[model samples]
Target: MTAFEATRAWAEAQDAADPLRAFRDEFHIPAHAGADTLYFCGNSLGLQPKGVRAAIEAELSDWAELAVEAHFRGRLPWMHYHEYVRDAMAEVVGARPHEVVAMNSLGANLHLMMVSFYRPTAERSAILMEAGAFPTDRYALESQVRFHGFDPSRDLIELQPDGPGGTLSMTAIERAIAEHGHRVALILLPGVQYRTGQVFDLEAIVRLGHAQGCVVGFDLAHAVGNLPLALHDAGPDFAVWCTYKYLNAGPGAVAGAFVHERHARADLPRFAGWWGHDKSTRFQMGPHFSPTPGADGWQLSNPPILALAPLRASLNVFTRSGMARLVEKSRRLTAYLDWLIRTRLDDTLDIVTPDDPTQRGAQLSIRVRAGRDAGRSLFEHLERHGVIGDWREPDVIRLSPVPLYNRYADCFGAVEAIEAWVR
Candidate 1:
């Protein structure tokens, strides 16, 4: 029959059998007059988990009763609250407790990382990044380079692909390293290219950069919680990612930093704060800046407990679901979305995300061929009809089927709606 009929049939059957079907109820999906818009923008802001409100209230209650003593009196203890989430975040990023610390915002953490890792000398001062890297990343690197009195045009090396397509081949990246290894001091790439949803080979990039004597770091803004990232195992000198994306932390949640064990003991200098100082003697209010060993030394200030509560709630969801399960469901759900978009939506659509499941996350960036406003029009129309997705730049629309809350039915519903509009 029609695409609508086919999509409905597939959705019904898949929902009946999905193992994660119950999880849909765990989140309060946005609803309109007729239906719940298939929310696919979790790549940007995650759906608030039902437990988040309760978690925050607990912290609020403890503060009301215990005052400053809440630091020592609460069940979780505000005094050592940041540490509570460190181990869980370490697990999420595949880092050791000492290798990962949740702190600061994405750009701030990137700058802090550069202060220690991007120690460009007079001779080797170039910082390498991709041409279409996230605007935040580009700006951060630009500022860091200039902070060291280096010119952006001369000191920053952007390794742009030779073509219009999304990802740069590993060969081209290596070649850039070979040619500029002498001048290059650091290489930064997104774990998943935000605009294209193209996953980079972190281990491979790490190996090549270290071989060239250049320190490597990853901007996992679109990668962490979207896919499995063995940050410590990837062997990058440092990496930073925001939690709001796939981690499902609330808006402007805390970002995390990963520094490989090799640099744990190094005299590499960083812009330090009181929290980064030795926790054991922090109460002593000492004058010396003795940093805590490992990634804990990266913390600049005491994190806000209220901001972290949502992450703690969200991480519990992940703790139960586990990375392996999340990755498996991510592949299948994304594959189903791809299948529906291609198999149902006619020739009017072009998917920029890689077809290889292992080479991408749940996001599929679609470039509509139906003229200039086609993508925007479709996005607005979909929102009107209760099918949510995000539009980027001039023509691309990013639809991320977050496995934690997204379902097979949502995937089918998105394509069915798109098919109706294209008609």
Candidate 2:
């Protein structure tokens, strides 16, 4: 990588050279003061894909034309709507098609996965996860622990971070697992830590958790679309993610899950529904339940086609651009943002996301040097100036330059806004 220059010309040149630069037009960047805002909030809700409107309209047309028949009629029939997204989504997450399924919201899918994976024995009845996990994950885990007739205080092991910037060290994780191996029934962690933008070692975590007789899983809300994942090869028992972030899908888009091929045939206990029954025999309406093989078996209800339409459109963009290329661009884009922040705003900001590019996705969580009130003021200033990043409570301002749409010049513009505020 060349030394980053803190100039608009340098930023434009970088953008000119970006192979993924054209992808920026695929999204509908929000307006501020009659121009496109420098959108740095893809880590939260992604900007809507331009194709999303057409995708949903197509479904709406079919609904009007065919009514209930739209399920089997239409350009993308509702009967198999989830299938339309399965392959592209699998490629995005680096999993086998059968191992993945588009389904309910993140929290609902987490609970469903827990129902099957969090089987606790009397001897080994604890759940292990990183401390300060996303509140939804903590809530799901705590509820699961209680549902299993165990005390969450006794059974939930929240591993504290020992690394800089509150990042978890693999050493600390291994040590925690080693100490609690006997009591741990499941290990749930994030593919990327939401607050700090720290990327966890999924493969290593899976290996360690399995060694400790734990069923491993991940909440990839921050990882999916932001990071290139190999969920099947990484070998977690399962993983879940919402499509709303980094995917360019609309808000509250249908979520996805991965259940490894190893469990495709396992007789695990699950909360079953009509949608999960064997497809060939699904409409047979038999008394006995026979599950569809692989992750499809976990579906509690049919997919919501309207919510899934935008995902289909967004995944199509991903399919065309490719995850590997997007990630390549992501590393460079984030590095540029990191450089701009450190070099230009070092006096006013402190980056909490790791300096190592491999340890993070696109997000850089920055804290203000002047303290929380100052940070909030700076954040408001950025917002006022049309730099759309997000403020996580206390002091951090998260800026994620999504590769699919964010430009290097956007990064430059954002830092310039910060520098303007500093001046």
Best-performing candidate as measured by lDDT = 2
Could you give candidate 2's per-residue lDDT for residues 292-400 as a string of tens digits? 9999999979889899999999999999999999899999999999988888777788899999988999999999988999999999999999999999876789999
* Per-residue accuracy of model 1 over 1-423 as CA lDDT, tens digit each: 223334576677766776877777778788787667689999999999999999999999999999899888897898788887888888888888899888889999998999998988899999999988889999999998998899999989998865334667778888998899888899999998888888889999999889989999999988889778788888999999999988888899988889899888778888889999888998899888988889889887888999999889888888888888889888888888897788777498989888889888999999888764888888898888888888888678999999888988888778878888988
TM-scores, all candidates, are 0.96, 0.99
Off by over 4 Å in 2: none
Candidate 2 residue-wise lDDT at 165: 74
Cα lDDT, all candidates: 0.86, 0.92
Summing lDDT over every window of 10 consecutive residues in candidate 1, give the lowest-scoring window: 1-10
Model 1: number of backbone collisions? 1
